[model samples]
Target: MSGDHILETQDLTREFKGFVAVNKVNLRVRRGTIHALIGPNGAGKTTCFNLLTKFLQPTSGRIFFEGQDITREAPAQVARRGVIRSFQISAVFPHLTVLENVRVALQRKYLGPSFQFWRSERTLNVLNERAMELLHAVDLQRYADLPAVELSYGRKRSLEIATTLAMEPRLMLLDEPTQGLGIEDVDRIRQLIKKVAADRTVLMVEHNMSVVSSIADTITVLQRGAVLAEGPYAQVSANPAVVEAYMGSANVELQGAH
Candidate 1:
């Protein structure tokens, strides 16, 4: 693999009771780029993600991050290595205020399970300041004092991004970030994602072609359990295989529209 890639999977495969979910799939994500993984349902996108994040063990093949082998690492070990994932559902603490949520994330990274930091008012002041900066990064500073659950759905997603950012990930994996949102919410989160990705690499699985086309520097199309196409949006959209794969799918029609 080239040195430019931040993450790479070589001949990655996963099987479930003889059912191949990901079949010898090789994926490369360039450093500091926003890459999107798109495919029809049952295409093994989720399985591939679980494998990369170490949530599932690969039946065979290897995963590497920043030139080091991580295929055998535990989930928390991989996360500590700077690969973080955001779930489809917002991961915010519902009862905590937005600011408190971000603060908790910061604490987890720096304080671990030690409660001594909580006893130090001075340390908390420092953490709060850092948390506010992250909240500002996601445009959630204004909602810092509100309960996390009180924010709008889109804002909750923003909060999730803030919490993810607090972890200071090198390669961020976002799963269907803009799903089930109104037009304005979608647009807002799209912009937020672009902003956060300025200094980090992002690998996202999204159903929204418009969002994918607008932000993804590279696109990888998965079909069945293998890669069907990989290129820029324009190139991948024009591939006959890609067009045929999405032919009957309403959501993917936007991808081939041009």
Candidate 2:
């Protein structure tokens, strides 16, 4: 990993039984840029994400963050290295107030895994100021008092991003940030991703070609677990092989996305 790139995978590969799910995938995400991994369904996009976060270990090859070999690091160890992942599904503490959810993350950050819930309110109050700031960053400060469950689906996703932010990640791996979103929510999350990427790096597995075209600085296309094309949206989208390998009907959508 050079100073110009925040994350890199050297022939990263994963297999299930006898089937190869990810094959010799070399990914290089530049520092402070929004990078996207895209392909048709079953292109091993999610599998690649799991490999990076250690949710699933690779069968071969290595992963590096800022040049450190993290191929064997545990998930917690990976996260501690400032590599945080947000799942495809909205992951929020439904019962906790929006503010409390972020505070819990802050507690984990400041107090470690043994964060004291039994501590005095005065002690915990110190975390509220920072918690509120995280909420404000995601535009959820107005809903601080409400249970996360009460929020619309889109807002719940926003809360998830805020909590991820509280972890102070150097590289955020977003897994389909707009997976089930409506048009409006998709737009909001797109802009939100771009905003956060201004200071830190982002590597995402996104299906929406429009979002990727609009926000991604680089796009890597995978086909049957291999890199089919990798470059800016314009360059990748123009590749004849990319157009042929694009997820069926999405080929039309990809063209229109531009």
User: In terms of lDDT, which candidate is strongest?
Assistant: 2
Worst 10 residues of 1 by lDDT: 113-122
TM for every model, in the order presented, reads: 0.95, 0.96
| Model 2 spans > 4 angstroms off | 117-120, 250-252
Cα lDDT for residue 160, candidate 1: 91
**Counted clashes in each candidate structure:** 0, 0
lDDT of 2 by residue, 1-258 (tens): 688988999999999998999999999999989999999888899999999999999999999999999999999999999999999998888898998888888988787677676778787788899999988888889999999999999999999999999999999999999888999999999989998898999999999998999999999999889999999999999899988876465333678784
Top candidate (TM-score): 2
lDDT of 1 by residue, 1-258 (tens): 789999999999999999999999999999999999999998999899999999999999999999999999999899989999998887888997999888887886677744353556566667888999998898888998999989999999989999888888999999999988899999999999999999999999999998998999999999998999999999898899998998898677654332
Give the distance in Å from residue 67's predicted Cα in candidate 2 to where it truly belongs: 0.6
- Assess the local accuracy of residue 229 in candidate 1 as a C-alpha lDDT between 0 and 100: 98
Supply the global lDDT for candidate 1.
0.90
> Model 2, residue 109: displacement in angstroms?
2.1
